[model samples]
Target: MEYRVLLAESDRSMLERLCQVVDDTPNFTLAAKFQNVSDALGQGAVFNPNLILLDIEQPGGMGLVDAFKKVYPAASILCMGDKWQAESASGSIKAGAKGYIIKPFSGVELQESVDAFSRLGSDGSAEILVFFSPKGKSGKTTLIANLAMSLARKSGEPVGIIDADLQFGDMAVFFNLAAQTTIVEAVRDIRFLSPASLSSYYMPVAPNVSVLCGTRTPNMIDKVAIDKLENLIAMSRGLFRYILIDVPAGFNPTSIAAAEASNTTFLVSMINGAYEIDHMKRALHIFRDWEDMENRAKVIFTRVEPCDAQARLELSQKLGYPVTEIIPNDYAIVSDAADKGKMATDIRPDSPLSRQVDRLADNIIGRKHRIRWAGV
Candidate 1:
C-alpha cells in the first residue's frame, strides 16, 4: 500500500532532510510538513496522510503520540529521535506510536522499524522464567538449553535464553556457538537500544530458539550492571514469547535480580548426597522472606535415581517444598551428546531424559501430560 506521509518536526534542517527522504522513497509521498506538532495535528486532515513521521526529540513529543492518534485514527505514528532510549520507546509505544528510529537513518530503516512494531503480537507480554541453583554443576544449564528447543517447538513461538552467569557462563559453548554479540555488549548499548533494535544481541541457534550469550570472560562481569541487565530483559519482552534466564549458582546480585524479575524460579539441584537436602532447606528458608515463595519458587532434583511418583512424593515430604519435577539419570547418551554439542533429546529421542524434558515442557505450557514409566 502507498503511504502518504505527514511530517512534524521542530528542527528545520532535520525537517528538510526528512522531507527529502520521504520524497525520494518509492510508495511514500510527502504530504505535508509542520514545525509544530499542534499545527500539524490541527491541520493534518487536509492532507489525509496514512503515515505520520513525528520527531520525538522535542520536549513532550513522545507523550503526544496518543493525541495525534486520537486526531487521525487511520494514520500510523512513527517516532524519530536524535538517539534511542529504552524508556522513550516504551513510553511512545504504550502511547500508541508504531515504532521508533534514530535520526540520520534511511528510508529503509524507517520502513523496517514501523513494520516491526506493527507486527507485535497481541497475546500480551512474554512469560519470564529463571533457573537457579545453590551451586554449579546441578544440570541447570543442560535443562535450560534443552528447554529452549522444547518450548519453541511445543508453543510454536520464539524462545529466548539469557545467561546471567556473567563470571562463568557457558551457554555459547553449550550451543557450540561463537556468538558475535554477548550480554555485556547489550547492556553497554542498552541505553540506545529499543525493543526491536535489541534483537541484534541475540544469536539464533535453532528453528525458534535464540540466546543472549554471557560475558566473554570472568572479569567482564563488572561491565554488566544489574540495573542495565534488567532493562535488557524488560525491553526483550516484546521480542519473544517466553524468556528463560540461567543464573549463576548460589545467590548474588545477578541471580537475585533475575529471580525477582521472573514469574517463577526453579530451584534446581542434583541427587548427590543427603547434604543436598540441607542446602535446599537453607535456600528455601531464605526464599521464605519473598512473597508467594511456595508457588513462584519450585524445586527440581535432576539425575534422580528413582524418578517415580512414589519417589517424588517421598522426596517432597522430606524437603517440605513439593518436588515439581525429577529427571532420571541418563549419563551415557548425555555424555555423548555433550561431546558432540547436541541436545540429549535431539540425539536420543527415546531416552528417559528426553521423555522427562518433553514432559517438563508440557507442564510449563499448562498442557496436560502423563508420565510413561509406571515404576523406576
Candidate 2:
C-alpha cells in the first residue's frame, strides 16, 4: 500500500519543507526530489512513482505536466502552487494533472491527496440520478438514502450520494455520519480534483454507499457556484455506478442544476394535505421545457395511503402525469430507522415499505416485477 512519490519544486524553502514532510510520512516513500524541471522530467520514469507532486507555477513547470503525462501515464499527477491560483490550476488540469493542492499543506493533506488518486479508475461512466422535491418535508432524503442502499446491493457496485441540499441537509443525520468534509469544499476544489481525489471528500456510511455532505452553515450555499456543482457531479459519474444527488427542495439554482445534470431526475412529492401535486405539476412544466427532460424526468408520490392499484390510478389521474412510484406511509418503521441512522429495509426486510422500495430498485435495474398484487 506504500505510494512512491516524486516531487519537483523550484523554490528552495518550499522544496526543503515538502521533502522533509514526505520523508516522514507513513505509507509514502520519497522516490526522488528535484529543484529543476529538467531533472524531474529527465529522471521521473526511473523512480516509477505512483504519485507526482509537481509545482506547475515554477519555470517550465507547466510544460512538464504534458511530458510526465506522456512518459508516466499511470502516475497520479498533482500540481502544487504557492497559493490557490485558479488559472494555473486550470491549465494543469487541461494538461492532464489529476488535481492541484495549495502549498505548505500538512502531511495529512498530502497523504489524503495521494490516497484519493489511488482509488480512481480509467472508466468514469455512471448513472446519475437526482432526487428533487418541489418543497420541504417531501421525504426526498429518506427515499434517496434507502434507494441508494437498495441500488448498491442490487448492482453490487458503489453508489455515491452528493447532499446538494446546501442550506440545511439532513444526510449526515440520516446516515449518522459525521460531517467530515462538506460539498462546499468539494465544489471549491473540484476544478483541481479527479475521481480518486473526489473520493476523499465522501464519508462511507454503508458498505457501498458513499456520501458527500452539505454545508455546515446555511450562508455557505452562495459559495457553491453553479459550474463547480456541475463539475462535481460530472467527476463523480466516473467513480461510481450510481450517483444519487439529494438536491435542495424547491426550484432554486442548485436543484435545477443537479436535475439537469442527472440522467434520471425523480421529482418526488409526498401525499401531504399541501398542494404538492400542484407544485409538482408546475415543476414538471419547467423541466419539460428543457432538453431531454420530458422523458428522463418522472414524478414519484411518497407517503401514499393504501398504495394499491386504485390509489395509484386515482393519483395519476389527479396529477395528470404517470406516477412512477407510490411509497406507502410507514411512519413507525421509518421513524425508528431514521432515529437509528439506518434504512427501514434493514430493520424489517419483509415490510410493505421495503417491498415497495425493492420494486423501485428492480424497475431501475430493468428487472421483471415479482410483486403479486392481484385484483385491486
Candidate 3:
C-alpha cells in the first residue's frame, strides 16, 4: 500500500532533505509539509496522512501529536529530533507518536521505524491489574513484582509492570534493575510511541516480564499528568498480555487514574493494626462506582497473622467484601528476597508466600476453581 507521509520540521534545509527522501522512496508519498505545527494540524486531517515525521521539540509540536491522534487514530506518528532527548522523547510518546528518531537520517531508517508498526500486529488489549493500598507499607510493590513473575510463568505470556507509584516506586530496586527509561519518560513520550517502540523503554527483569520504572526524581511525579497516564496504560495494553501497575497509596490523581483504568483493582492491606480493615473499607467506598466493582475488585490482606478462617471471616464481615487472598506474615523470607532483589518465584518456589501469590495469579487468570485455603 502507498503510505501517505507528512513531514514537519522547523529546519528548512533538513525539512527539504526529508521531503526528497519521502518523494524518492517507493510505496511512500509526501502528502504535505507545513511551516509549523499549527498549519500541519489545520491541514493534517484533510490529507489523512498515514505517516508523520514531526519535530517534537518545536512549539506546538507536542500538541500536534494529540491533534493527529484525535483526527487520525490509525496514522503512525514519528517524532523527529536533532538529537535523542530521552526525557522529552517520552513526552512525545505520550502525545501519541509511534516513535522518535534522530534526524539527518536516510529513507531506510524512517522506513524501518515506520514499518515496525506492521510487525507489531493489531494493537491487542491486555488484562490490567492495579495494586493499591489506602496506606503505604503494605508491601504492594513486592506483591506486584512477584505476581508479575508468577503470571508470566503460568500463562506463558508477556507481562508488563508500570510502576505508577512515582514518588517512591521501588520495583526497579526490588527487581534488581537499574534506572534506565522509566514510566515517567514513557508517559511523556507515549504519543510518539508504537507497541514496538514502547517496548524499548522497559527494563526486562525476567523472561516475558518487563518493568517500567517510576520517575527517578521523586518530585517529577508531579509532572506525570493523569490523562497522559490513561493514555500510557491504554497504549501499553496493546503490547502485553497482562499489565500490572503498582500505584501510590491513598486516593491521589495517579492512583485514581490507574485504578479507574484497571480491569482488576486489588485493594491491598497489610494487617499491621486493628484498624486495617477500616482502611480497606474507606478504599472500597471510593471504588463503589466501578463497573461490576464487586467482581473486578479484590481485597488482599497481606502479612495476615493467624491467617485462619476466623480471621478471614471477621475481616470479611467488617469490610463487607470477601477476603480475596491472604498472604501470611513471612517477614524473613520477604525481606531476604527484597534485599536480594529476587522475585518470590525465584527465591523460594515452594514457600508458602510464593504458593499463595501463585494461587492469586491463577485466580486472576480465571482458569481455575476458587482456591481452598490451606492452613496458614
The per-candidate count of clashes, in order, stands at 0, 2, 19
168-251: candidate 2 lDDT, tens digit per residue: 988888988888689999988875664556788999988888999988889998989998888788767545778889988889
lDDT of 1 by residue, 287-344 (tens): 8878788768888889998777887888888998788888888788778888998889
Q: Which ten residues in a row have the lowest lDDT in candidate 1?
A: 367-376
Model 3: lowest-lDDT 10 consecutive positions = 367-376
Regions of model 2 farther than 4 Å from truth: 1-124, 367-376
lDDT of each: 0.82, 0.80, 0.79
Q: Write the per-residue lDDT of candidate 3 for residues 182-282, one digit (tens) a residue.
A: 88788788766655567789888888898889888799987789888887887676567789999989999888888878878899989887788888888
When superposed on Cα atoms, how far off is each prediction in RMSD? 4.8, 6.6, 8.1
Highest TM-score: which candidate? 1
Per-model TM-score versus the true fold: 0.79, 0.68, 0.68
Candidate 3: C-alpha lDDT: 0.79
Choose the strongest candidate by lDDT.
1
Q: Which candidate would rank higher by TM-score, 1 or 3?
A: 1
